[model samples]
Target: MLITFIISSALLTLITLAPLLPSNHWTVRVWEFPRLQIVFLILINILLMALLIAQDLGPFLALVIVNLCLLCYQINWIFPYTPFANTTVKMSKSSDLSSRIKVINVNVLMSNRDAHKLIALVEQHQPHLLVTLESNQWWQDALEPLHDAYPYRVNYPLDNLYGMHLFSRIPLSDITTAERVEQGVPSIHCIANLHNGKQIQCHFLHPAPPSPTENEESTERDIELLGLAREIANKQGSDSLPVLVSGDLNDVAWSPTTQAFLRISGLQDPRIGRGAYNTFHAQYAFARWPLDHIFHSEHFELVSLSRLSEIGSDHFPLLTEIHLK
Candidate 1:
């Protein structure tokens, strides 16, 4: 029991400290996703160690102190996502439907064949914009019926898992599909004309994640995000256009990269002070994080934010409504 406790504590400590390193390698970056899980394990370790403290007083006390500090550190990063923290985006006070933008963002697992579930969700929600990631040619065909309701569309279907599609009830113009960092991975950018005749810039991204099976490093993902942030900052500086960025960012909302993206772009995350709203790993509640995100500029305020029911994919869909302020 003593040996097992020590090993678990040591491993938890290492994982807690891993993300603080500056390396963008997959081995290191992957550890950033499970801070909540680590906190849970650390608490268990502390309890177990407390029971066995008599056997090894000095070492057990030292481990407890270290774990306590680590617990505080992990909580600091996640606290803002809890309801205790003040909301970064203010709540909407407007009742005008024309000033509101409703969005549904989903990452349909590339090989999952349950298209009807997602289609049903779109019909139920009837969002102004629907963004789908990892959608290939088959998924595109399955979603064809939506064209009647969502007349404005941006489709770039590919066999690659990074394919993205955008369907809009609102008019979309200046649509561009660009390969920001990687050649095959595509992201969609466009201007959405709201019912009130206001134009808001919308960007949909599905950057490659850092993993052994995918890109070995997070450089490309970071570059794509930070690059887009710079562009949005510059554009807003010039025209002060309202902007909304949504998709499977492949990074957790609490990660350093995402924090930097929010700061640089001056965008507001509705998740902050609301809830984590973990979207990925729909099959396993224990192994989930908020990977799908919807961020907006100061021009918008949150009307509603929710993690919708599962649609037979690795990720749950996110439905967000923001009122133009």
Candidate 2:
């Protein structure tokens, strides 16, 4: 029994290392999805090893050491998301309420038929801009009431899970629907003119995840992020306008791809000092990571960010308020 336990711990350690390879295959890419689970298992394995340590002193000690090493590595990846880490974006202390803009993002799971909860949330928040993904014609009709309050709209309501719709009460100009990396997947890009006479370039995306049911590899997802990052990078400047990018990114905030995108685009995540605010798999708290993201350039400071109530979807809506600096 002791030998079997040791082998099990060693196997878990190897599984944690599999993601270190440079392969984008679904099997390898998926390792990034369960870091939290791996960390938990590592801890439990260590405690079990301690109880069994008296059985085989040397071997069990080695097992505990290995688990500790893996635990440190996993924690290092996730520590920046806790309040202990410095925030990537400065918090907004500006008292100018007019300069503040609130944006809400929701991935209304395509198969979810109920829209009453979603509609209610909209009525309650009444954000300056509301972005929705995986919305079909049915959703479009159900959300028609938005047109009354939100005069400006950019919509691509398709049965495809990648459909996107942007509703804004503020002025939206130069709106464009782009199929940057894949045809079925669409992204919304436009300029949001704030009441303070400032323009915020906005981009909303929902890239495909690496799963057996979806793409077999993460190449498309990686490419889509890189392309968007490059576009944002090109626009980076000292006197450039503020830019906001948000949606169900379908990737963890701590993944290499996400970090690389931040470095390339020079955008900041408000969740650095804040908690994970993990939005995906809303029903499973322990199994959640930050999949829905809101990233912005240095031109804006954080006001408030939180995960709103569920809307019969797998993801919880993300609400972020920022003040242009």
Q: Candidate 1 lDDT (Cα, whole model)?
A: 0.91
In TM-score terms, candidate 2 sits at 0.97
Q: What's the TM-score of each model vs. the native?
A: 0.97, 0.97
> lDDT for every model?
0.91, 0.89
Per-residue lDDT of 49 in model 2: 74
Error of 1 at 63 (Å): 1.1
lDDT of 2 at 234: 96
Error of 2 at 104 (Å): 0.8
Q: Highest lDDT among the candidates is held by which one?
A: 1
Clashing pairs in 2: none
What lDDT tens digits, residue by residue, belong to model 2 across residues 153-204?
A: 9889988798899999999999999898888999999999988788999999
Error of 2 at 123 (Å): 1.6
Task: Write the residue-wise lDDT of candidate 1 on 53-167 in tens digits.
Answer: 7676775676788878988999999899999999888898888989999999999998999999999999998999999999999999999989999999898998989889999
Q: Where does model 2 exceed 4 Å of error?
A: 54-56
Q: Residue-pair clashes per candidate, as listed?
A: 0, 0
